[model samples]
Target chain A: MDHNWDFASVLANKTLLLIGLKNTLVLGSVCLALGLFFGLFVGAARFSGKSWLYYPATAFVELFRNTPVLVQIMWFFFAFPIIAPFKIDAFTAATLGLTLNTVAFSSEIYRAGLQSIHKGQWEAGKALGMSYWQQMRRVVLPQAVRRMLPAFMNRAVELFKMTSLASVIAYGELMYQAKVVSTISFNPIEMYTSVALIFFLVLFPATILVRRFEARDTFRR
Target chain B: MTEVLRIEGLHKSFAELEVLKGIDLSVNKGETVVLLGASGSGKSTLLRCVNFMEIPTSGRIHLEGKAIGSARNGRVAYAERELTQLRSRVGMVFQHFNLFPHMTALENVMEGPRTVLKCDSSECRRRGEKYLDKVGLGWKADAYPSQLSGGQQQRIAIARALAMEPEIMLFDEATSALDPELVGEVLETMKELAEEGMTMLIVTHELGFAYTVADKVLFLSEGSILEQGTPAEVLTYPRQDATKNFLRGHNMFRLPEPQID
Candidate 1:
């Protein structure tokens, strides 16, 4: 059987893909921001030395990181409605699932970064008369952020790819729109290729930006 | 002269080893004291205990006659914050020259005054510049630690410590990390400070420099003070066998002629 490439069919779904692309951007941006906030809390708490603060945060990170994201999306979509009386939409569920996953991974990244800092840094801060909080904020966090640069970016890339799984929750993002167009037009190659291109467009610059940041930091050193 | 620093019944241990066994040291105001010791003699550990950088196993340390950084007579007199506040009065310069890598030389000097002392920006900057110049690093104000020589970095570290305007300063092998050719510059800077009446306790192997600048020279061996006296007395007329042995072993003191056999 000869394969006929349908350029027009792919082009016709541009509007759908544009809307999907917009949704994907919104989802990734929100998840990244909220994930960082939650992740910082989790990461800082894990090292806070208080058992009560660390243990529950550790459990949350482990539960999210160990399980599959598809199951998490399903739990949020199908199971959360059962446990809670509030009716939630697919996008909300997808956003929540993605945010939780990002938090788990980012917290681990932060913990490793924080641990890599020389104990001397803390001592130097303390010796300079900095309070414990000041030591962590002014001295520890800046050094840790620099040390975690590569890992932080890699996690963002991972989160970007993971957004593809949001399709399972019927979030109407890029992957879901790609599936709909390919099924209707029967042009899997063209539609999927276009989908891959859209992803590259969204993720490629972020990777470059993160790399630039790493480069600038290294150069500073 | 009144005492600026006094340590009594100071002891420190790690696991099975006792590093400092009841070290009692005192430095009068405006006096320069040099601690001489071989490797693993616990001179550095003694300095750490002075600033509460390493919590002593048990001890009493007084700074300017005030019970600070450690306890006295069974009561916990200083909390962590108060101990930190006390540390601001006693600056320390390390052998490795622990300047923050991200900060400029001037910024490193300014950090203590700005962050700890809460000095206004103009005053901090002015004092930073003066100290940097005093240490002969006036031109390297904007350079990072990586850009400076080992000696230059140590000088910057000294400047950073001095910017705190501390009443007492501790030098833990300050010039030990520098090139032999570069060591003289830092020692000269420190000697000048000593002449200016800066109370200092220096742990060093530079016996000649120690002899020239220190009012009192202390020889530590096996985690205890083996000998201490004026430099002429300690270097020229050592009374202890251990001091004589250490000097001879390190080629610091000339050995007597061996009988021809």
Candidate 2:
């Protein structure tokens, strides 16, 4: 057994690691913001159904939630260009896949949040002369957001971890860069450890944020 | 004086569970009518129907001499926009004191004037403060609803309704949520409103308050008005056995004993 561990090689490619870090952050942020937007839309559409809006949104959510994320990534990267011909790059394909996945999960979280608000809320809004949209915008969303923060933050961390799947599409994010460094330096353990550390650097703070937000509204939960 | 609100042959049901059964009711300009009823007696539903919150199955409602309910393709309909306007005209206070939890007492009062009435910010602010003062919450304008007690929140709700300058106000068991000790403060505010001749319909169990403040008291049972008369007549000398039984069942009335010579 040859025990020759080289930590220097892993640290030496700081530049490549930094590029990978930047890509991870960019993808994570975009996925978080857009994921929430589409997730809220899907959740609201599911809840406020006129049948026309409900079935299609319900199908979209079920399709994304039921399938594996890896399959979704592969489809968006390889098969989507053939079918839709959008000609999306690896980064765009990964972002799209991650967005759809996050939204489906987040939509369920949001539906739970929206349903928890008491019926008295709607009656009170009506009594105040609030239009249906005004009640949702002014009253329901504000209350639901407070209830949804912890779940949203948890899903955000999950989304961050899921970014590793983007590596399958050659997205050049942290995991892909780690694999390239390992292949070149022939030091799989150290290279992968460095990548895991990078993930910890990003994910630990998100977990803390969720804890803090939950602490602030302990009564609500 | 004109009739501010009129309900004729109003019927409402929920999947054959009839809530309001062919009820006829009216209120003249500036009249304060209090409805007394047991739980599940349709008093709340009737109030909701008057504001068009629950569309009547079949009925005619007139507000300020204009029909509030209309027929569309042989089916009665209330347009969403019309319902919004009708609700604005008739503000309501709920049993649980459903104040917007995020807003301060002042902001709760300001929402209607700013959003529905389109009052300018300056006017809205001024009127909101004034109404808060009217409801005895001027000192608590900046306090959030959750920070306030149930009674205080109920008072803010009343002030919020008053901010709309509604031609009529509806109260659906407004004081029921308050701690028994705190109920007096909210009842005091309503009494003040009644004394000022604000056109109002109240659904309440506070027998003493109805006897004191109501121009007329309506007693409801099952899905219809069991009886209606001046407070002294209905609460004291009831003609209907159903109304008498209801009052006795709630332990809300006691007949005077015969004198022995």
Candidate 3:
């Protein structure tokens, strides 16, 4: 069957798509910021020589990394309400699920950056009488940050794409809104086509930004 | 005068191999002691043990008559906090010049003062600039380690160590990694330091620099000091077989003519 496409139906409901698109971007960015913040601590603790800090951090990273995001989202959406001290809506559950997943991957990236530093750097810090944490904060981590930037940008893109999985929990993000539009319009192909267009519009510039940041730090690296 | 540094029965072993035997040495105040040896002769190992960098298997090290790593119930005991303070007093320069790549030359010099000493920025920066100029790197203070040449980096490393105002400086083949031409500039700075009465222990193969600068010369062989004396006594005279052989290898075994009245 030769199909004649109509985007006007999707455009007529542009407000719904735009709102869902905002939800997607906001959730992705919030998750990213929190994930990166928590991930650095997890990564640093994972690299800690002390057993007490290392084991718990390892468990956190492994539990999130090994499970599928869909399973996690469902678990949070259903189970977290019962387990948590207070009731949480699907929006909070989805945000938490996305953040948990991103933290696990990002923590590993941070660990990779930490280990990329040379052993002599630590010794140099010691020779200068800088304490252990001072070495990390002042010497090793500064160099590691440069090494991890490309990996971090990659994670941002990955998390943005993964936000689509929030649809499973009936979260009002881009994918969930698209399903609503398609069901009502009864034109799955056209509605989904516009959804794809909106996603591309948001992510393309983001990818370009990552590339520019990488190029700027090329000589420094 | 009391010795500024003393090592007694210092022994270091890695697995089955003993890298440094029961070594004994002493460095008096304002003296520059030079260590000469072939590769694997333990000159570097002996120097490292001074600041407990290598953690000698068994030894007693004293700085100005104060024993490092206090003995507790016949066992050597060290508190890490105290050790860090002690190490800062003993500055070191490496052959590869391990400068912090992200920091400028001035920043590298100021790091010790700022972080360890907790000096204010104004004091640290002023002292850093003074040391940079001391090393003839005043114009290059803002340059990163990668931006500088090998010799310049090594000098910056020296200036970094000097900023700590260490009581004794250890140079582990400081000029070995420099270009032949660049070597002179670093050696000149070190010579000036020695002349200014900075007690130093140097492990190097630069015979000319050693001949010109050593207050005492020690020849190490097979993890032990084989010969040691004034440079005139050790370098220009026939001594042990190991010392003679090492000098002969460098084609420098000729002793001065005997004086006749």
Rank by DockQ (best first): 1, 2, 3
TM-score on alpha carbons, each prediction: 0.92, 0.94, 0.90
Residue B191, candidate 2: how far off, in angstroms?
0.7
Candidate 2: what lDDT? Answer: 0.88
Give model 2's share of reference contacts: 0.55
Residue A151, model 2: Cα distance from true site in angstroms: 1.6
Which prediction has more favorable TM-score, 1 or 3? 1
Candidate order by decreasing lDDT: 3, 2, 1
lDDT of candidate 1?
A: 0.87
Cα deviation in Å at residue B122, candidate 3? 1.9
lDDT tens digits, residues B128-238, model 3? 999999999999988889889999999999999999998899999999888889999999999999999999999998887889999999999999998999888888894
List model 3 lDDT by residue over A66-170, tens digit each.
999989999999988887899888789988999988889999999889988988788788877777888899999988998788789988988988898999889
Tell me chain A's TM-score in each of the predictions: 0.93, 0.94, 0.93
Model 3, residue B11: distance off in Å is 2.6
Q: Write down the worst ten-residue block by lDDT for model 1 chain B.
A: B69-78
Question: In candidate 1, what are the lDDT values of residues A30-130, reduced to their tens digit?
Answer: 88888988998898888777999899989999999999988898899999988888998988898889899989889888888888878877777677778
Best by TM-score: 2
